[model samples]
Target: MIDQSLIDLWHGFGVAFQFHNLMWSFFGVLVGNLIGVLPGMGAMSAMSMLLPLTYVMNPVSAILMLAGIFYGSQYGGAIGAILLNLPCHPPHAVTCIDGYPLTKRGKGGTALGITMISSFFAASVGIIVMIFASPLLVQIAFKFGPAELFSIMLVGLIAGGTMSRGAPIKGVSMTVLGLILGMVGTDVNSGVQRFTFGFPDLADNLEIVALALGLFGVAEFLLNVNRMGAVGSNMKLGMKDMRPSRAELKTAFWPMVRGTLMGMLFGAMPGTGPTITTFLSYSVEKKISKNPRSFGTGNIAGVAAPEAASHSKTQVDFIPTMSLGIPGDPVMALILGALLIQGIQPGPQLITEHADIFWGLIASFWIGNILLIILNVPLIGVWVKMLRVPYKYLFPLAMVFICVGVFTTQNSLFRVGEVAVFGILGAILLLLKFPVSPILLGYVLGPMLEENFRRALLISDGSLQVFVATPISATFIGISCLLILLQLLFWLRNLMRARKVRESAGVPT
Candidate 1:
């Protein structure tokens, strides 16, 4: 199977290596890097902006470019986080902990170098996993009925809550809120409006583009503005400072490998995203490190681990999205949407029917990673300098691009307004110290969860026991239960420890 897949992938490379495909891929990397360097611009916004242009190109070339944009920006995102203390995307947030400190210590170039090397290594591993594991994963995907899917989605939601930095209750509430917001549009099953509030445009549904822009872009802009007064004014990178020392590389090497493995596992799981992968990788590295106290400082391992995991997950995310048509994230959903528009159905038959696309996409991952390594490292100085651009000038341009992109999606101003509203909501959530990632996760997965849960209920005639009847579903439920129990125990132990500390201090418990 591996050899056959490689042969098919080579056939795909034959197509992807063409002049037009290569050019688009380059264009995508360029655009993605620009967006990634700029604060607040995410992959979804970048993809949404480019979605229309794809109609004019060959579907294969277009998809290759889009895929490049998706992961290429990841390389750039680390630059912004490390140099500017501004994370362009959510997953890049973890990099800020150590990356920015490295920059502050005049090692911005070194941080960028380690980030590039680690990302490339992790991406290579992830792409290999995608190529080999997809077939088996697809077969298992086929066995999932609606109930099983719903169960999986529930597990994802719960996992997101458990992963939160704040109160689990708050995370759960936010997820529920996201679900309620997701339900606001017209119901597909009954064709009845749920929460449109008499708005004709909204009767169709809230556009994910608008929401994502508002949440990530607009909200991020506001937050940046709030901190503008204290932000660093200079962005400079010396050539000598950019290169990592032999010791730095030696330290980061194993951590990168560990992060790559962790990312591959998590990314292959449905509904998990790079944010979780990065956080988990960072925590794991810290736990196992000889100098764990240096984690949040300027530790090179801190930068390498999360950055590698974040990039690796991009490759792994395609596994479920391509094979089962179950989008692991919003970006995957957009890719899946593009596949559908091209008249290519995603599932088990996808590999057999469109071998070229499957193999081409897989091969392109390898090509794109090579391109990113080539383009990003030498240009690290240029990207580091991007932080010098004033937020006042940069943010307005970003908003313009965002508005134009949102408007262009459907040629509607209402959609642009929707983006603004969501942006405000995102800002408020950020101010309240609430996590925004779960909201998007919930919104993206909510409808699917509902559809699957209903389908399972119908199949079982409303008897819930069917969930336990299937071996796969039973296993999923069992794992979910165990995870919940473990988390509960951890929480209780922490609470008891806190009470004991307070008692020791002679404070009221």
Candidate 2:
């Protein structure tokens, strides 16, 4: 079956490589890279902006262009994150932890190269996984009841929560806060108004672009303003500085392999996103490192691992979106929306009914990744030059982009106002030493968790025991419980160790 599918995929390349689709893929990738270079304009926004333009084209061609935009932006996002301490996209926020440090250490170019190499390798591996794993995953997805889905989401949330670097309490707090924010809109089943506070603009849900811009983009700029001189002094820009030695590449290779596996698995899971997977990849890298304490200060594995996971995750997100019609996150949601607009429904029947569309899109991932590598290597020096720009002048421009991008998202000034609201909130959280990533993870997963839970209850006639009745659901719940228990044990063990040290030092007892 896999062999036949590979043959079909080869046929897909034949279709994708047609003159028209090929041209659109190249053009789309170029445009997406430009969009990624500009902070706050995520791939979803870029695809949304381009959705109407695709209406005039054929379905396969349209999809080719949009997919190009999404995966191409993977590399472009790293540029802003490393060079300016700006994530430019949510997944890249994970990159900022070590990527910015590397940039500060005058290894911006080398960091960018690792991002490119790891991304290329990971994306290649992701495509291979998609080719082989889609059939298997979709089969399992068919067996997944709402309870199983809910249980999986629970573990995902817990895994994300425990991965925080600072106080675990702060991470959990932010995640809970994100869940509250996710509840701000009207309920889908009951049609009841939620925490909207009478604001009609939130009748659907909070805008992702607005939240991301304010939390990561605007808040980051505000924090940087006071430290402009220090930021400027740290960046060393040149071609030579970008190259890494044999040791660095060798160290990052195995981490990249591990990160790719994580990305392929999590990225294919419904409701999961690259941001979470990147965080998980970073967590895994730190966990396995011989010198774990060196992670945040500037570790190449830190840069390679998360970047690899994020890039691969972006591509594999298409697996469920294309195979089961289950979107992993908002970007996949938009991609799904685009297919619906094209009068195509993606599901188990997708490959059988629309073989060309399915295969063509798969083949396009390869082309887009290649084009991105070709574009990215040469653009490293140019991206590094951006660091030399004075923050005093650059930040105001960033604010303008944030405002404009938010407004364009919904054609509402109200959404722009939401940026200020979240910006202040994010700034406060940053000052309080809270982990902001959990907030995002919470916000993204909260809706899915609720939807799945309700669906499960409805299917089981409101019986609470239904969650444990099914084998898959029971397995997931059991795993989630075990994971939480293990984390608790670790936390308690650390607490006792700290207490012992304090007692010995006579500081406190």
RMSD in order of candidates: 4.8, 2.7
Model 1: per-residue Cα lDDT over 177-222, one tens digit each:
7788778877877889988888989887787667765776677678
Q: Across residues 112-185, which tens digit of lDDT does each residue of candidate 2 receive? A: 87888899899998888788788776665567667887887777677667566687778788889888988988
Candidate 1 Cα deviation (angstroms), residue 241:
5.3
| Total backbone collisions for each predicted model | 2, 0
Worst 10 residues of 1 by lDDT: 226-235
lDDT of 2: 0.81
The C-alpha TM-scores of every prediction are 0.76, 0.90
lDDT of 1: 0.77
Which pairs clash (backbone N, Cα, C closer than 3 Å) in model 1? Answer: 109-242, 214-423
Q: Which stretches in model 1 have alpha-carbon errors above 4 Å? A: 1-21, 35-63, 73-115, 130-134, 224-230, 234-236, 239-361, 501-509
The Cα RMSD of model 1 versus the native structure comes to 4.8
Residue 84 shift from truth in candidate 2, angstroms: 2.4
lDDT of each: 0.77, 0.81
TM-score of 2: 0.90
